[model samples]
Target: MGKVTGFLEFQRLQEAAEAPANRLKHYKEFVLHLTDDQARQQGARCMDCGIPFCNTACPVNNIIPDWNDLVYRQDWSRALDVLHSTNNFPEFTGRVCPAPCEAACTLNINDAPVGIKSIEHAIIDKGWQEGWVKPQVPRIKTGKSVAVVGSGPSGLACAQQLARAGHAVTVFEKSDRIGGLLRYGIPDFKMEKSHIDRRVSQMELEGVAFRTSTFVGSAEDAALFGQGLSTVTPAQLEAEFDAVVIAGGSEAPRDLNIPGRELQGVHFAMDFLRQQNKVVAGDKLPGQTTAAGKKVVVIGGGDTGSDCVGTSNRQGAKSVVQFELMPQPPEVENRELTWPYWPARLRTSSSHEEGCDRDWGVTTKSFKGKNGKLTALECARVEWVRDEATGQMKMNEIEGSVFDVPADLVFFAMGFVSPVQKVLDAFGVERDGRGNARANTDDYRTNRDKVFAAGDMRRGQSLVVWAIREGRQCAASVDAWLMGSTTLPR
Candidate 1:
């Protein structure tokens, strides 16, 4: 530790956010990062807890204490090195990760925990500003060719690691651009696309080839292989590469099976979000739908739904309403019982602060519309209770709580069910009970030999941090399988 009594001397400080009125006008990230001195003070608050649970709590298992100590000692260069050792994309996680590490902090038991996320944000931003972040091109070529499907966080991380290991790596992306969800599903106000652009450049410099608009296992490409893949057809990817890794994210959205689902104005949240992202990227849409002057109703109250609310507000929607099936959670958790674990409690995002009417313990029954366009949603309040015998929670509709809310546009942000079956079926990969790609977390190998799966495709919908972690570990597994040994960190 830099200072024995540093924790006692410094108070926790978080990054500031732009004011609502000023920030709502634009779709740019508005988080104000800490100055160097303030970041050091925040880093000093990392108590010398003997256990260092924050490290384990982090998805990428970042060495939080080491970086915090380094930052506190004003060693910026060493801090960036330590920060980047485990996690490939600190900048992304620093901005959007829920920061479970903070909750696990020992100081969180009685006081504010260390602002580890902000400190990381500072370290990475400083690294970029100082031109310390650069491609680490491998010195020797291994000549082992690897093909990674999907260009999301998982695939990108895997490709980068494999490239640095001196393997010939090619990343295939179905979209026109590299980043999957990060470049589309996420709103710009949360994280700009420039971060992904820079990483893409770095990966290219490190000898990782990116092939955008290349669908590896599309129906047209099925004739290329002899033995077929279980999740993707074997013929499609067989002769092109020595090893194939599937890092495609979960894209099968959970649908609300209700009346008027076919209405023109109703759309999946991702469709709307992706379109907006494309527009921001300078792609013109002739008939793009806008929320302006429309009464928008967003289903699901998770982060995706919150993103919809923010986007709707930015589009000048007449009104925005969000609904959740579960009952509202407490504003604060019972910390004594939930400390050192991610607590289940209410979370209000910046989008919610922009403007929204939130309702919980409610379910939409049907959609009503005119001329094939959605106009209103019929919904009812529900109550949940525990069953005496089974001890399972059950929901029942309230007898007199049914009502209709006007909705000119409806966005379903209910989250994904699994990876699209077409891709998995094309390869013939086996699935678990949840319809996710069935692969072992320990080795990341699928049922098919020479093929592996990771990220949301294997674990279901999860955080970017988890995706990156899976990618890194999966790369190590693949490398070990290819060479019979590997030096890559898990």
Candidate 2:
């Protein structure tokens, strides 16, 4: 610990954002990173809890205490090294992760936790500014080839690691650009694309080849999540590459199949969000679905839903409302009981703070409209009752609780169910009952030999941090398989 009494001396300070009024006019990152002194002070707040639960809580298992002390000592060069030891992309996680590590901080038991995320954001930003981030070209070539499908966080992580391990790695991306979901699914206001661009440059310099607009599946799979300009058969990949890694994210969005789901103006959250991202990248989309000047209602109270709220407001929606079927969680958690673990509690994001009418325990029954255009949503208040047999909560609509709310546009953000089956089937990989690619965490190997799966593709939809962890681990497994042994970290 840099300072034994630092925790008692300083309180946690988070990054500040530009005013909503000003930020809504443009799609840009507004959360200001901490200043050098501020980061140092925040690092000083890291108490010697004897056990750094933040490390375990983080999906990538970052060495939190070491980096904290390094930052406190102003040894930023070493801090960056420590930051990159476990996580391949600290910049991405620092920008968008919800910071479960903070929730598990020992200080969070009774006080505000150390500002670990902001410190990380500061460290990576500084590393870039100082020209410290560079290519890690392998000294020797192993001559083994690897094909990584999907260029999202996980795929990128795995490809980078494999390339560093002296393998000839070629990343196949179905999209026109790299970064599967990060390039399309997330809003630009949260994280600009240039961050991904610079990382791609670094990876390219490290001897990794990127094949964009290349689909690795059967012809019928074109209609699935990733559409490609060119197609490569699974047989071709198997015959050429020594190993194949499926890092494609879970892209099968869960649909609301109630009555009137076919109505126009009702769309999946990704459709709206993806369009905005393309527009920001200078692509002109004709008849683009937007929330401008319309009453908007977003279903599902998750990060995607909050993104819809922020995007809708930015698009000049007249009104925005969010609905969640589950009952509202408490504003605060019982930290005493849930110490050293992620606690379940209400989380109000910056988008919510910008503007939104949020209602919990609300279910949409159907759409009420005419001429195939949505006009309103028929909804009902429901209560969750525990089922004795399953011991799981089931939704029950209350009598006389039905109501209608004006909704010119509706975005369903209920999350994804699984990866597109066509891609998995093309690779001859097995799937779990939940529809995700079936593979154990130990080796991330699928039923098919020379094929492995990781990230959301294997574990279903999860956080970006988790995806990076899986990618790193999967790369280690692939290296071990190809070389009969590997020195890469898990």
Candidate 3:
């Protein structure tokens, strides 16, 4: 409440960005965080609502109004403190999180919501620039040791939290680099790897050891399900660490079992994206799949599909098309029906804005190829109809509507199914019906003693912010289970 009438006086402002033409030339972050004044004005726009829906809407439940007030008062240092109280990685969420908090803002009922994400981006960027972001090394050491599998946002957050709570924490990553999904699965243009690198440096400073290129399973399991440089058996990990957490990503991509699935030039979106990320990191990957000089078709209209479009355009694809099996969402949401919740509406990403032919209410019947090479997709228009008996909508292909989408390359981005099962099998952990490791949110403990699961490995594929929240909560649970009490927050 620095200025009670500030909401009436200010308009929501967006972060600036590089022009698409200029940004497509390099695989660096194109968008810029708000400047100091822009951040202050944005913060001031947060109304003095009786209740803060933005906080609850955020996965981490960030203390939004407090930080907004501090930012409006120009108390940068305290603003950073309030920002970091709940979320460990504001910078990551600020950049990539599809800000649900903004959608639920009280001001959004009738006006543009407060620019919370932009303010967070500004605050965190400034915290780094001003050296306010520093390691919170524990003052006293607890002899208890813990091992965290995977090094994505969730794993990293959990490891950092436990390390700060005076437990010796070690993070395991199968890849040569630490960040599992963030290091590879995401395209460099969306978020440069340098952001992950600096955080790794900070975690190391706080005594959270990172073991890269190391598999934490049997040798046989390592060979079958892991791509690590070294192997550490589950028994060894169990005997050495006081507790263990399975926090890897949901890597089992939902596959398209069409005729040309085995054909060359047809690939899962992550495989295509990961290889490009490694290439951008200066790794020489021979026969790297490229959309350059090819007509590209990306299936499954989601963030993954949008990323493929952006990456393909950067690689000089001849043309790009995206398909969504479901019906198109409304261009604008009905606020009255969906207030304070995530709305179903068409979302045009920056990648889409760059260029893409997006089609909805369509499905690929089969992949069309020649000489074992993918050349096009045999697609068809479809309608969704309700089944009264089942109360579920079913797809009905429209007769005589089959068509071909010519393509030289195709990427399937239909989302993930579950965590890599071999890893779970190697650990002897049980699974839910959906195949995610069986665990409850209350304590995040698995059926096996000394084992816990969180993030995508437990809850299936979700947003990065949700992963961070789960990781934080899981850490608190692990801490409590080890010492019979915990001071750490969820």
Cα TM-score of candidate 3: 0.98
Cα lDDT tens digits for candidate 1, 67-137: 99999888999999999999999989988898999999988888888899999999999999999999999
Instruction: Looking at model 3, report the run of 10 residues with the lowest lDDT sum.
Output: 220-229
lDDT of 2 by residue, 3-52 (tens): 98999999889798899899999999999999999999999999989989
Candidate 3, residues 1-490, lDDT tens digits: the string is 8888889999888889999889889899989998888888888888889899999999999999999999998899999999998998888888889999999999999999999999999899999999998999999999999999999999999999999999999999888898888889888888888889999899899999989888877777678654546998777888999999989999999998978789888899999999899999999988899999999999989999999999999999999999999999999899999989999999999999888999999999888888999888999999999999999999999999999999999999999999989789888999999999999999999988899999999999999999999999999999999999999998
Highest lDDT model number = 2
- Candidate 3 clash figure, as a count: 0
TM-score of each: 0.96, 0.99, 0.98
Higher-scoring candidate on TM-score, 1 or 3: 3
Ranking of all candidate structures by their lDDT, best first: 2, 3, 1
The 10-residue segment with the lowest total lDDT in model 1: 222-231
Q: List candidate 1 segments past 4 Å from native.
A: 220-234
